[model samples]
Target: MFRTVQDFIEDYRDESQNTLKLLNLLTDESLKSANTPGFRSLGHLAWHLVHDDAGMLRRIGLDFKAPPAGAEPPESAAAIAAAYRETAESMLEAASRWSDEKLLESHNMFGRNWQNGLTLLMFVKHEVHHRGQLTVLMRQAGLQTAGVYGPTKEEWEKMGMTAPK
Candidate 1:
């Protein structure tokens, strides 16, 4: 969990950029890819990633510019990528104002009391979880994905090296 607002902001900056890199690889047509019928499509998940930050941050008393919940994702994947970048910037700005003391304060969240710090941590984890899902769907859609956390198989090959087992 984050003990300082700066730590949270820094982590978000890196993770959000990672997310944006993967999101930019999506095409409008690939948004239709899903693991199964009735499952959430890439479009829905991408849009969720685009807007979930503002919604979660709003719960912690930080408001940012994002589309309303349930808003349709723009038809262009580039637009979705652009919106994610902007909303991430807004979240960083809002979170930067929090103090260590304020982060330690408890609040009722989802029927349970939680420290503001925990909430911010959860926000980062949530982005990571969904971004992982997006990567899987990206592969299913035949798009080359940028690996986060480590180099992908193709990335390793591009460097004329073998990926570790």
Candidate 2:
């Protein structure tokens, strides 16, 4: 869990950039990719990251520019990437004002009382979870994925090393 607002900020800065890199790789048509028919599509998962970030922050009394909960994602992959970038900036700006003490305060989140720190932690964890899903969808759509923690299989080959099987 985040103990200081700065911790969350620093982590978010890195993670959000990683997300942006992957988002930029998405093609307009690839957004339709999913694990199976009738499942959530790549577009829906990406847009959820955008909307949920702002919605969760707003619920905690930090309002920012983001799509409304029910808003449909644009067909353009660039638009979704732009929205994610913009909303992430807004969230960083809004969160910058929070003090460590404020992070320790309890607030009702999803019907349970939680520290603001936990909420911030959830922000990163939730995004990471969906990001993993998006990567699978990206692969299914035949798109190359950006590396998050380390080089991908192709990236390893680019480095002239065998990728672990």
Candidate 3:
């Protein structure tokens, strides 16, 4: 959870970049890949991140339009990424206008009250959880996953370096 506006902004920027990097690793074909017959596909996971963030924003009293419903279960990967970027930018801009006291105050979401900081932290965690799934899906699809938190195996090989022990 963030205590200061700067803290949230810095973390958001870093995390959002990581999310984008993961999203970029996905190809149009791989977007349909799923772990099992009835499981959510890669594109569905991407789309969920966008809509979930918007829901979080709404919980905090920020108004943003939800992404349009897609004919496909989760929509195109590109569309999901685009919506995430747009909503994230707008949320950051709104956050800039909030005072420290306001950020720390409690807000009601889903019948429970939580500090704004908690809500923001949950948003980051939610994205990271889905991103982990995407990394696995990318590997299954024979795509090169980026070294998000650290070097991916492919990245290490490309650099002529041994994989970490």
lDDT of each: 0.87, 0.87, 0.75
Colliding pairs, model 3: none
TM-score of 1: 0.95
Among residues 3 or more apart in sequence or in different chains, the pairs in candidate 2 whose N, CA or C atoms overlap within 3 Å are none
Candidate 2 residue lDDT tens string, 77-125: 9999999999899988888988888888877888899888888898899
Q: Residue 61 error for model 2, in Å?
A: 1.6
2 against 3, candidate with superior TM-score: 2
Residue runs of model 2 more than 4 Å from their true location after superposition = none
Clash count for each candidate, listed in order shown: 0, 0, 0
TM-score of each model, in listed order: 0.95, 0.95, 0.86
lDDT string, candidate 3, 1-109, tens digits: 7787777878988888888888766677888888789888887877676665346666676555556444243445676677778867776777777777766878877
Q: On residues 2-119, what C-alpha lDDT tens digit does candidate 1 reach at each position? A: 8998999899999999999999999999987788998889888898998863465677787778778778888899999999999999988878777778788777777888888998
- RMSD for each of the candidates: 1.4, 1.4, 2.4
The 10 consecutive residues of candidate 3 with the worst lDDT sum are 66-75
